[model samples]
Target: MSLPTSTASPTPTRSTPRPATPSHRSGYRTGLRWLLQTHGFMFLWALGMLVVLVAAATIIVSNVTTPAGSIVQHARQGLTWFPFSIAIVGITTYTNIHIGAGLTRRSLGWAALTAAVVMAVAYAALFTLALQLERAVYGWTGWAHGVDGAGGLFTSSGQVGLVVLDVGLLFLAGQLSGVLVGIVYYRAGGWWGTLALPLTAGPILLATPALSTAALGDLGLAPRVVLVLLVLGAMSLAAHRLILGVQVRKLAT
Candidate 1:
């Protein structure tokens, strides 16, 4: 008898692929570092320029007539605008590069925010110190250091906390508004951005009511602080909304 032929098919083998090892790309950390470096350099450079300009102005004014008061407060107020402008430019120009290099939009947004807060705090501290230095110089020269003329939270006497808070809030608002404008321009292009300017800049404009008590005529401390905080919150929310799910645009060569 012929042996029965085996008809059982060979067992099919399935090759299992191994799971990928977790990647520690350090993308978030890298983005944060970049933000800090960029922000730090811009701030220092702008501050240096401001110091030179203020010193020149003071010298020129003094030659004509002894300026009655220090310009520290004025200088700090003006300096608030720079951080915002710098942040806007940085965000608009660098988003594509950062994303392409493996950074998430969410990470970039948070990093930008953290850098803004740090920048604000640093500026506030430096500005306060500069004012103190001005006061000392005024003392040495027998001149009054009365340029705290804007007469709001920042201009208050012996209130370093309030001054820091005011400056911090202003810078925060400025930074956020800058981001909003940049994002709007990037998403909506030129004409739409121009039309949207008032909305994007609303927070900055609103803060003015609280920032310059002299111009608004003593709106009271609580009310002014509340206004500033509200504007800051609004701007912050707008920034987040603008930043989420942001699409990176292609740059022209």
Candidate 2:
């Protein structure tokens, strides 16, 4: 009886396999979500402000003795600085809080990068649309559309693709410079950050050629565009490296 009982083997049990994890996709989505959370309202606010400024400038310039062309110049400069200021403040102010809340520095850097690209594209599109609307309104109102060299590449060249590239590069440079400044300030304090001004600002200055109608010395469109793209890439890489080992400071500090 003992031998017979031992001869029979127990049936094997199969454990359920763990679900596959899409880590890269999850990480990318998480980073994108974080950026949207942080900068989402900023974008909306900037757009609203831009509309108001454009409207006010248009009305006053058309009615007063002011040159109508100044409106476009004002808009262009405003858009250029909007993202720059936001990024600089946001990165310095929020990076520690974001890390304390469970996000990695790398993740935040990626998020910032994504946010910068999206912001640039949106700004370019919105600026272009605003100018086009202004043109239509001017035509309907029998006022001259005074867009000239100050109108930026898209306004002056009337090329959507070119303007997008130009504006996008400008914003990218601004965004990168802002992040670079933030990192410099964070790691080296205000004194070193001030000392690092030229290094941090070089990228933004490079964007001038792309954003302006003024001739880039000895550089054609192709060369200028290439230079801009190269500067953007270099700035992005510098920002990334700077963020990798950043020490998170306490809120009070």
- Pairs with steric clashes in candidate 1: none
Q: Highest lDDT among the candidates is held by which one?
A: 1
Worst 10 residues of 2 by lDDT: 1-10
Candidate 1, residues 1-253: lDDT per residue as tens digits? Answer: 1111221221122232432531222433455567677888987887787678767876887789877777777766576788778877877776777788866676566656656667788787777777777677767877667756464466543567777777777777787788888878877788998899899867777786577767667568788788788777767666766776788776767
Clash list (residue pairs), candidate 2: none
Q: Pick by TM-score: which candidate is best? A: 1
Instruction: Write candidate 2's Cα lDDT for 1-253 as tens digits.
Output: 0112211232122232432663333333455565555566787887899788778877776677644452544566677777777778777876776676655666566666666777777777877777677767766776666655533454453465776777778877887788888888888888999999899977787678655666554446677778788888888888877876889865563
For all predicted structures, in order, the TM-scores are: 0.82, 0.81
